[model samples]
Target chain A: MKKRKQRVNSFMVNGLLLFLCLVWTVPTFGLLMTSFRDRDVVSKTGWWTVFTRPDQAELTLDNYEQVLSGKTITLVDSKGNQQTVKGDNLTRAFLNSLTVSIPAVVIPILIASFAAYGFAWMDFPGRKVFFILVVALLVVPLQISLIPLLRDYGRLELTGTFLAIWLAHTGFGLPLSVYLMYNYISQLPRSIIESAIIDGCSHFGVFWKLILPLSVPAIASLAIFQFLWVWNDLLVALVFIGSKPGVEVLTQRLLYLIGSRGQDWHLLCAGAFISMALPLMVFISLQRYFVRGLLAGSVKG
Target chain B: MAGVRLEKIEKTYPNGFKAVHGIDLDIRDGEFMVLVGPSGCAKSTTLRMVAGLEEISGGKVLIGDRLVNDVEPKDRDIAMVFQNYALYPHMTVYKNMSWVLKLKKKPADEIDRRVRQAADILGLTDMLDRKPKQLSGGQMQRVAVGRAIVRSPKVFLFDEPLSNLDAKLRVQMRVEISRLHTKLKNTMIYVTHDQVEAMTMGDRICVMELGRIKQVDTPTNLYRYPANTFVAGFIGSPSMNIVSARLNFDGDTCYVDSQNLHLRIPDDIGKKVRQYDGKAIYFGIRPEHIHARETNPEAADNFFNMEVSVVENMGNEVYLYFTPGNSQYIARIDPDIPVRSGDSHEMWLDTNYIHLFDGETKENLIYKPKTQ
Candidate 1:
């Protein structure tokens, strides 16, 4: 039953944590480094060399200029019409990622919070059976949902659109979001809910006035989880939205940087960091809600 | 305000555990009734049934003659204060106190007014903006009461609301609840496993055990004349000491023998017990009635010799634990007099205050105390 106090001598524990920190930092570190390094210097030397080569300015305003500059990235469609991608190339893609990910993250969370509140508190017939089925969907791989969801909407002529990808992510994200939220919410004090009922609160009153306010922590943490999942997701987007020609996403743009230019990996790195801005900020800010605020109402004085 | 009536109320859980055997009690409008018992006694279940929280299995529950077994809790016109206080942690004290009014769609100004009034009553006006997490246990409890009072529901149900408070606060709130009863004058049913709360706050206390009403009476009556052996022991502090005795009557004289003690019954008991001359009975007395007295030849009615076992001084009063010829008893005596362990002190029984029960039925054979 003893826990050995970890020391610097215990290299494995410290090393794993150090290694994870390094793993986490290296990419963002690379993106930050690549954003500043000159085009030729970035291609020829690893980002680690900026430390040894004191003569080279790894950081510059020109990389920033080229990245921020509005340039047309063109794609020839099946009928061979060239469409110009608009805005600051990175700025346009940032908007595209926002359009796709925000709704993808929000639609599921909004729907799931209601579903979770219902699953945890409501007493309609077949509710238990349906809730169990919904949670069971958590074990379902998102890849399994992609084809059927895309094909069903594809028949309605909805494929290759952001709506298709958003709906797909919503469907994919809802199961796990509801499952996570259900666990957090089911632990709320029964007495408070019952007292709410006695206090002239209808079920909706309980949901809106009692549950929604109390569920902030659960909803916040779940938002972070679902937001990050949909934001970082490549497969769902790639299958539905990314493969489209004119409406290329940030990940698609980053992917093309590797294929067409192959040497413009710094631009790709810059593009990836721009896409990650919201989720990273959101996860960092709202992460504390996951610590344990839902228990506050349950174990009152 | 509304009175409550439960007619043939029954509760059978989904798991088929029948918690409440059928119970029927009419709680008067604007009166305070307490459902008191040991844990698992179904007193809480009964209260919940009346509160429209627990679904009844049979018969009817009425609030102001309205059949409410099927009414939604919000529509039932009842407010409940939970044992743990069950405050909404995310809400400020003001919001918690104002929730019911807000739910009722009361005007902002009115909700504010009523909440402030409740806060003033509970001495929590300064704590209105704090969440339940930041407040002390007593403060949170006041907010709960505040929530209930804001609704001004036709009835109030308290499920061991004071049990979560400290001993001192529990006693203080006990008095406060009684005062609140007079101020608000709504039908209130309280549930607790603590007998003292039942005795102090209830106008009519229902003492329950194992899903059945053991006894229902006023506190004074329950103390002076418990209906059965269970109530006899359950209602009192330090409990009523009971000893089995064999009754014997010889012409005009009567005696009861309990192995070691052969005591002559008083003329009143000595008269009633005359018919059951050869029957077995229980002899009971409250600790306060047993007194230490100077032996006098003429004071035949009150004298007995005690083999003192332990003397406990609780500052103001001394508790004498002694065996009088084999019957173990406690005597709450004046502390100014010195008594020690292993000393034989002459003690007196206020014989008129003793109780007798039939050993088989456990029913009180004594006449009831006069109504206050």
Candidate 2:
């Protein structure tokens, strides 16, 4: 009876997990199939129809080709006025996203790792109080701070530049980054750190030679999270960079592609997949580190 | 190698708890000193102070005549092996051993030579390419020792390094560490809770309790003449059995009288303890000193008959547990003796090996052995 109950429990758990997986992947699968279909067919039938009606599976690259080619887009405003907005090329927007996200990811992690090591290992006055202050910042919603930050950026005359967006992302990302890195780094055995000190390693030597290399799994996982966050972010870029033609990121470009009517679903699907390509590759390549990093400090070796 | 001198060292936390109370110790050059005590005795705290890992709240710490209280651990030229081994999991054995040399900017070939030499000494050459997680507990322990040996520092501090190993492995590593001390000839300060380790390994042992040093002496001297009741009971395996007794003098003979048993004190020990006549005192006797009456009738001075409560046969010998009056006593006797539970047997106490301690203070009253 016990064995039968266990089997039933396991079966129920597996079924629930499979249902969640399908609920998540089915929409993305539809979007992928829609992105490859001809524009007229995408509007005429649901994406699932391509599996049954083989005629609708006539794949075309015209949506992607037109989106990447860069042309003038006609947008209608709320008052029914037509405005021509020149669409930024997909390739340039992709490069701009890289310019913003890479540093935004790298700079915060670099600063947070140092802050985390100090918070975790070094003894100093007000260490606990300072750490608590940093953690408290985690609860402050970024939405509430955006207007004030944009005002400060305007005062500094740094609006609509890569530096402004990079700095904004870094500021928003630092608290949680430090908190996470501290949790992982502090769990390391104290004797190992002390042994390094006795082994003639100065503080910087210990940080550079020992702590950083040992933290690769954590750093890689943090990189994936930050990269995906900054890449998919539209509000921060739209507020800071203001949808300027040359400085617009992939998300801003995708928003421009949708315009006011939301009639360009086929182009939107193609542009969405294009923007997602890099983050998807990154997550796939570093999935192992992600799992390991989450479990690292929870158990002893 | 240099000696370490801790003069009136004290450690008081910010919250006003004193962990080590004014400890004064001198570890000589090329000597093995073991600081031993039960838990919460501050042995590890003292070792850390010497390693520059803990801040000294009061007094001075000197390494080779240079005051090092303010020096960082990296500049103190000391190596320590923690109880958990603390080998770097990310680095191979070779890298773990050579990282210090690399930090010092030594030539690559020199680093290789020193690492290989230390690894060879520890018999870790075959596994130098493996990481710490790939190694067994004993292997990780050896790598920790090897990492310390590679630096060849002035002093080696070990904080219960063998406590994590299995019982059989602990014994094997104990001999290996003693051999390492002989080969290195460096001043070593080891802290452990096990008195057997202290006895077999230390050139001089410092027994502590409640953050105060109880006694400091050689192993044999500690066994023969413990300065206080705590050391006497702590150092021996079966522990010295202490019971309340009274010392009485009759003409020239001295006798110790308990509630149910009366024992004559040998002349040599009686003379030293005779000043406490008619006074309540604590009498201590080791298990081995008590013999079965049938086997050693000639050595019997204080004879008693008691019902045996339990009998443990230890192959070559037997342990007879019994209650003589209100006090329980264990006697290590011949296994051939037909002693069983509920059976009355005659037992002899060899009075020569007995110890007398002050009833109030528990200090040894009969003898004060000189420490080496």
Candidate 2 to truth, TM: 0.93
Looking at model 2 chain A, which ten-residue stretch has the lowest summed lDDT?
A: A292-301
Among the numbered candidates, top TM-score falls to: 2
Q: Write the per-residue lDDT of candidate 2 for residues B1-372, one digit (tens) a residue.
A: 899998999999999999999988888999999999999999999999999999999989999999999999988889999888877777888998898888888999999999999999999999989877778888889999998998889999999999988899999999999999999999999999999999999999999998889999889989999998999999987788889889999977999988877999888888888789999999999999988898776764689888999898889998888886678898898888788888999888888899999999999998876643
Model 1 CA RMSD to the hidden true structure, in angstroms? 4.7
TM-scores, all candidates, are 0.87, 0.93
DockQ, candidate no. 2: 0.40
Residue pairs clashing in model 2 are: none
Docking class of 1: acceptable
Candidate 1 per-residue C-alpha lDDT over B266-371 given as tens digits, one digit per residue, 9 for 90 to 100: 7877887677788999878888888778423456654667678999889989899987665689888898878889998888877677888888987788765332
In order, candidate lDDTs are: 0.80, 0.89
